[model samples]
Target: MTVVAADAAVSQVDAAAAAASTRPRCSTEDMLQLLQDYDCWVFDLDGTIWRGNEVIEGVLEALELLRKLGKKVLFMTNNSMKSRGSYLDKCLQVGLPAHVDDIYCSSYSAAAYLDSIGFDRSKKAYVVGERGIMQELAAVGIESFGGPDDNEKRASFSSEMLHDTQVGAVVCGVDPNLSYYKVQYASMCLLLNPGCLFIATNTDARGHFTPNLEWAGAGATVGAIKGVVERDPIVTGKPSPFLMQDIAAKHNVQPAKSIMVGDRLDTDILWGLNTGMATLLVMTGVTDEQLLVAQRGSSNGVKPHFVMDSFGDLRRVAQQALQQQK
Candidate 1:
């Protein structure tokens, strides 16, 4: 062919590719076929599944579909304000059926890890955060307690617990009602035990539901405590391997075959992308489509292979993958 003819042919190809790009996307089957290349499902809570007291539409259906398909599903969250039991209650409240074993929290991971390293928590503990952190410590078979005693079951707390105990380690999490005593106690413990591990559930500054005015999550609190004591905390939540390790160790999830689905680009998506796992960004929570796409353009490695508006959407995608395999 002549040179001019060759140039014309290339232009036509370019136009065809552009036209296909702007065309409507694939159906649910297409999406699943694309996603089923791998098989692990790691879901994030708060915004992706539920916001405040309301469950996101199609969430339960999505989870149910995943289970029926025999896909490995695990629930993971950075919120340290609640323990696994608290998460269990939240799941029930939101109409998502989940057992305690199915959910993983930062506090649970942090406490279990600390216990494995030979920190005896069952004797006496000086807690620095909320009910969730305390709940996790209790689950680790550690005897740590914080604040004051109001009755038999609950540890009615004040700033006094910081002054009362000999101290082992300092745990940090969201305590919206964070009293001055809590901070004082944490600082005191750090001052006493410089070798104490400072474990924080997450560093997210805001809550998904409320986004409170005084919001500075466990990360900020850890900073404050560290500043006073001149130390740094070991974070175990989003963008960290702590929660991922917890799930893989306890569950049958295979990272090579697993994918992380979350609403937040910084936490859930980043966790997977950075750690060599497949990532899917859902529009139901903290991050929507626009935000993630924009981040992908700016950051070198922030894009999820799959972008979804709802968990229900994944059901179709799963079926498609199964079909494609055959």
Candidate 2:
């Protein structure tokens, strides 16, 4: 994850506009052809696969159908609330067979970025998130400090309080128990400490993982610290493009032979477009039909190559594809 300018992101949006102009929405024949074309399918978890505690009705069958057709399946998520293991657990709990290696989240991406950069484990990261951030870092042998612990709870901080000198980075994620103290301490690490890295799992404003409970997302915590520190973070989640590259490198996924399915237009669709992969927008989570129509011809945001009413629709297509393969 590296800090990128607003212009860099805006430029991606503009590029997407030009590329999308020549493409038409998928027809029934196009849908079946798409299923036949891709050998790998990457799906967003929160809305595409499951919503809250319940699994999206036909997605489980869809995944099975895809696997039966010898397709590789992977889960890509921007929700940094949990580690990859947790996500895998959730997938299995809801009846999807998920292997640990098949799950990817912003947390793991951040860890991989740090690992690639040879981050000094000797220096601790001042965390402004939940235990998941710490857990992922630990899995990568990176040390972190200050998240959801009793000592971090209700801690008093003033301008006079001494900053932790050993803190070399300010890592932010989804902190449900976010306090002013977390922001203050993280800001101090970034502003006062020399050579401090500012990292964010994702910059999503809110979470839609669970229905009816709109939780403040990791972006909120990152934004709070960014406001205090007057800096931009190296976002390691969706829309980063680096993440998609990493995915391809790790899983040997060919861009032309893989597809990304998600409910969010900005993050999910943008990631796919930016990384040269096919994008599918599902109407199960964030983006609705009205918004999709309004943005259809806009040059300011990313557009999907195909749009489906739900992943269940994709499931039906995959089912047909499987039958034809027999």
- Most lDDT-accurate candidate: 2
Q: Relative to the unseen true structure, what is the C-alpha lDDT of residue 178 in candidate 1, on a scale of 0 to 100?
A: 56
Instruction: Give the runs in model 2 whose Cα sits over 4 Å from its true position.
Output: 1-25, 150-152, 155-159
Compare the candidates by TM-score and give the number of the best one.
2
> How well does candidate 1 match the true structure in TM-score terms?
0.78
Give one digit per residue, the lDDT tens place, for model 1 in 1-326: 01112123434554443343322223565466545555678888866777667676677876776766677778888887778998999898777888899888877866876776888644356555667777787777776666233112222454234254456777777655555556666777777764656777777765564421224566567767777878667777787876666677777667878888887787788889766788777655655333444565574647676666566566555555555556
lDDT of 2 by residue, 1-326 (tens): 11212223334554554465445446679888887788889999887787778777788988899889888999999877689999888888888998898998988878877887899989988877777778999998988878887234554534356678889888888888888777778887898889999999888876674664556788789889888888899988887877766777778999889899998888889888878889998766776544565678676856798876667766777777877888
Query: Residue 234 of candidate 1: its Cα lDDT?
Result: 73
Count of clashes, each model: 10, 0
TM-score of 2: 0.89
TM-score of each: 0.78, 0.89
Residue 184's lDDT in candidate 2: 76
